[model samples]
Target: MTRDHSKTFYFGSRFFPLPQRQAVWAVYAACRVGDDIVDEPGGGPVVLSDWWARVQSALTGRVAFSQAGPHPVDLALGWAAGQFPIPVSAFQELYLGLRMDLEGQVYRDMDDLELYCRRVAGVVGFMIAPICGYSGGDRTLEYALRLGQAMQLTNILRDVGEDLARGRLYLPESLLNEYGVTPAMLEAAEVTPEYCALMRHLTALARTWYAEGRAGIPQLQGSGRLAVTAAARAYEGILDALERNGYDNFRRRASVSGTRKLLMLPQAWWEMKLG
Candidate 1:
């Protein structure tokens, strides 16, 4: 699922030991399906409720390795929970984020958007960190959450044009107004000076999150440190790609090429081990 759904994630997860990698894949599958519920066309409350029930059952130790029922994602999730101290609250928080989507709630400002990002993406870090092993306790966890938020923000920036076309806008209205970028300008896909400035502001904030996130990597144990380091560098490369395109997110999606990702691995390893 990771390979098929997300190449960037696959690239990072490949570095993990087989067991941890499989478990991470399970968590990713669970989260990915829930997100699909919100993003897929014709998804409604009924389908979401069924999905949520399976998650609860899986996390509570219900196992179904057969082809009978409970879904493949739930089975993998059940397996992962048995192997690790996987947090139930993380998925509960993710469910809340999906509910917000179902309700069509508007993000009032950066704080609101950050909360949304935490629910959907930050909790993912929470799920993955314990499996990776960390020594600094909550401080490290907080850094992981911030890292996830940075990636989420990166996704937001990359998907702005796509989201707007779907009649959805994740850009906080406050920032838009502050930058003198009107909704009309966004709707028209205009890459005006004001729009570029707004993008630059967000890019800077994402970079700060990335810096803080990297600080926690040295605190992680084993291959997990390198896994996260490579992932962070690869994801951060999207911000660079976006800048290279002159912040014209409307015309194209930002991505780091495979060659750049391969080049990042050794550097990520050296930085994590020595720096």
Candidate 2:
């Protein structure tokens, strides 16, 4: 089941030095493939079914999973898992999360959203944390989980209009009900004061989660703390951009440009070391 890492993922792995970089690239490549299966268009039920079955079999040691799917990412992940101490449970959780996406399940509330985030994003953190030499302490896992939640929350906020267009709503119904903003209204791209207020409220919550996530960086091993800091700060910057725009995700997608991300690296370094 061994395979070369995904090209883009390999390049991205250059941030780390030596063997750690190789290990991370393999994991990223696998995740990238799993992501493609769920995110890419034109994947039919049969294709997804086969992919899911292979993922399970590969993880369970029932079959050899090399680069045989629509993409080589999963094969790469299998190889990487075999070569390292990556958490298989986390990878399984990630696959299950993608399966949910394939089924087009929508979030009903924060609890549902948390479940989805835990499977899809939280598990990725868990998988990476162990690779980064973070022990499975409550504080470390808690921060990783919150970081994942924050990332998911930011994604949800950024993609609200797009998700609504595709008949998905991530904003908790209870909050929407409390605000008296209906799904139809959100679908119509209504940027009313109520909607704006709701978005701001949501962003505030995401910021809190990001703060909690950052608290556990000091506990990371090797250069992982720096890498995670860069990634987290870059993501947080996206949320900041959303906030600066008065919580307007409808007019344009919020992003932190490469140049800004470059600037963030130094800041992340400072936060990881001096701060």
Taking every candidate in turn, the Cα RMSD to the unseen true structure, in Å, is 1.6, 3.9
Q: What ranges in model 1 sit over 4 Å off? A: 63-68
Alpha carbon lDDT of each predicted model: 0.89, 0.71
**Residue-wise lDDT of candidate 1 within 1-275, one digit each (tens)?**
88888778788988899999999999999989988888889787898887888888898897544467568888889989999888999999999988888888787799989998899888889999988989899999999999998988999999899888767788898999999999889989999999999999999999999998888888888999989999999999999999999999999999988999999988998998785
The 10-residue segment of model 2 with minimum total lDDT is: 1-10
Clashing pairs in 2: none
The C-alpha local distance difference test score for the whole of candidate 2 amounts to 0.71
TM-score of each: 0.96, 0.85
lDDT for residue 138 in candidate 1, whole number 0-100: 95
Q: Which tens-of-lDDT digit does each residue in 184-220 have in candidate 2?
A: 6776777888988888788888899889888887888
RMSD of candidate 1 to the truth, in angstroms, is 1.6
